[model samples]
Target: MTVTEELVRKRAEHNEGEICSLEELALHQQDIEKIEFLNKNCKKLRILYLQNNLISRIENINRLKELEYLNLALNNIEIIENLEGCESLKKLELTVNFIGDLTSVENLVNLGTLEELYLIGNPCTDYTGYREYVIATLPQLKVLDGEEIGKSERITAFQNLSKHYKTILKSQEDYFYKRVCRFLSVNVQALEKVQAQQRRETFSKKLEENNGDIEKIAKEFWQEKGPYTPESRTETYEFLRLQKEQESQKAASFEETKPRRKIFFAEDGRPYNINEPKIEFKFYEEIMENEQYFVLDIAAYKNMDTSLIDCDVQTNYVRVTLRNKVFQMALPEEVHPDKSSVQRSRVTGRLLVRMPKVKSSSIIEPQNTKWKRTTGSVEKTESKDKMKGGKSNFLTVGETTASVDWRNITNAEDSRSGDLEMQKRAPVHRRKERENSPSFVDNPDVPPLE
Candidate 1:
């Protein structure tokens, strides 16, 4: 698991802009073996967490000048070196590591801003006069291994340092030789294979416990660890990163194997309809003076090239091509292909298609209209006087003209009886005038009531 640029980027946050803008990063428990790509990609990092990994050497991080905190706990790091460039570093955590070189505390003598150091559970912590040596060497350290160094303690450490200096060096050299001998005697390849097997077994057990569901196991594990913690965040990021890679690979394979489709007519000579671009659109029909038109509006991107769009209007349907995608829609009414037109709006980038409907002519015959006038008056002489003038009301149909003679008009018996029955069924509610209330009298001298 060599730390690559991709892994570093995936484990980082606030990196949407240039990589140099990254300030804080977490790469814990990722099995990363070496620190890489950060010195070039994230030179402005302020805080970094690289604990619980397989990293053995601290290198390639001298460019992080703004770093304030560095966590390298639970790693295979043996010696502390190459940290002279972190000018603003205030806290360093190297707990639970294999660091046995007590003389490595000399690396902090140049770090003036370093205030706290943690070397708990490390081989170097058990060295004789370890606390005194560290306190005397790094004078700016306010706390060491969860304990605060007082003025009196710092003075006593300085006083005892000269007496224990040669003894500490001798012990450090012996431990170094033993560490080298152990490193040479162990089978590195077999150890790595065992570690890998153990990890797989752990994963398999978790999967079985969750009924062989990877997602369920992952959810349970992260939930048990709680949220907003380093472990949970790291695990979640790794899971998502692997998922994205798998999805990308599957997509690439699918694209390579997918069959191309025909957009227009099929092999059977039947027209084909397809909407490969999957553009959202609206369609409607309008009528103006017996002329029907079909309007189709396609929503397209504003920056899309206008040359990519093509349209073909047919009698029963309209076909549109958008960036090699065929979009065909059926129209209820047939349209004239020659008169159809298409336009695109510059402001909204919408494809507007105007198709004129096919015109149809209907054959009709003119018929004669009969006119009859019914009057309540029964006097023939009065009707005759009314028709004496040539200005009679007449209706003309095509080339024939006709007029009605009121003197010869007659009403039907059923119509007259029906009218009389309707009048009888009417409920007329009225009050008769008060007869005895007052009597009207005309006065010549009195004016009307003011």
Candidate 2:
């Protein structure tokens, strides 16, 4: 880990940039004077984390011209104006720090490339009077704290707010909308939010309807195969659901894009880590979204044997992982959030998203099985000869007919449960029905006609 990254991780946040706990580095008095020499002297620095520090004034930070992400969260920093000269700043996190007058950010208009801004955990967030002023001023600023900004985020945020009110008001008698309508604000932004609110409500209703329909056909897909208690299951899904909700809410509220990291694609057809990574994480997210709505938040240092169910819009999803003889759910997504976008963001700058960290040795278990199973299974049957282990070899999703030829099983009842299982467990984005699976003969087993 880089020295700067080490500092951020050991104290303030997790490897994913999510804040772990305030207790990690609960500074009674943040000593900024110690870092003053580093701030001015570390000319190569790009991301600066002064969060949870006792830095009352940010006037000295104007000199770090190359700084991109500046975290002044949880500090005594009273003014945002002193950050004038840091035009290169792209992300700024100022969540818990109380800056009474948000006009302090007007000087940040110079930060053209600025994308994500965290303003959560602050009193100024509730002040609606000057919100439009801030939004109107910052155009490139897409994500403010956790949500999207001026264009998309604000529009979605307001829309959600409006729908919640309108739905409650509609259910009530005539005394509601009229008495509460004025407080709903009649600005164009508010109208946009209202419109967005309608869209989300419509979407949620549609989801509820679809979920009901799915409960019928997807009975086999429902998971009842885990060693989970009511509380454990509830907690797991709740964590996952809450996590997805947070991300979805952030996505809706965000106009800014995530920072791209360098990835290395090697000639061996495997990823080779480079000093400057060539492949970026944003593309990965886009792909993951296109393929599945829920992401399995696994540990960076450990292999992921489990997963969770999270949300796509504002709802929760389940995450699952199957391996060897065991299957499990990692974490749940129903975590509650008290912070708002006008609050600070949990993370800033780019983070290296380590994949599940699987090793081939780990993939095969007992260490005794590799020799035993391979040799034993090899002699079982000629039909088995053609088949892979419990896991089948399938072609890429977009690949040709040969890949899906296994789906030629003519009867649905003919051990075709594997395909059905895939359909059941596949994430919403990844659900695919093979048209060529002729449903005639089961490849895993011989045909009755034969």
- What TM-score would every model get versus the actual structure? 0.47, 0.29
Error of 2 at 201 (Å): 57
What TM-score quantifies how close candidate 1 is to the native fold?
0.47
Count clashes in each candidate, considering only residues at least 3 apart in sequence or on different chains: 0, 49
Task: Give a tens-digit lDDT track for model 2, residues 1-450.
Answer: 112434544444432443322222222223442334334444545666666555556755577777777777766554577677777888888877655556566778888878888777654565553344455557677776666654565565554554444433333334234324533556744864676467456545655676423233234323434322222333334434544565576676564565433333346534332222122222121122122212233222123222321111111222111221111222122211221011111243222221211111112122122222232233222233455675444323342535335556556676777688888998786678867666666576765675
**What C-alpha RMSD separates each model from the true structure?**
14.1, 34.1
Q: Predict model 2's lDDT versus the native.
A: 0.46
| lDDT string, candidate 1, 366-405, tens digits | 1333233335322112243455564545434344355567
Return the lDDT, model 1, position 257: 91
> How many steric clashes does model 1 contain?
0
Off by over 4 Å in 1: 1-56, 59-76, 85-88, 93-102, 118-137, 143-182, 186-248, 258-280, 287-291, 299-316, 320-326, 332-339, 343-350, 358-450
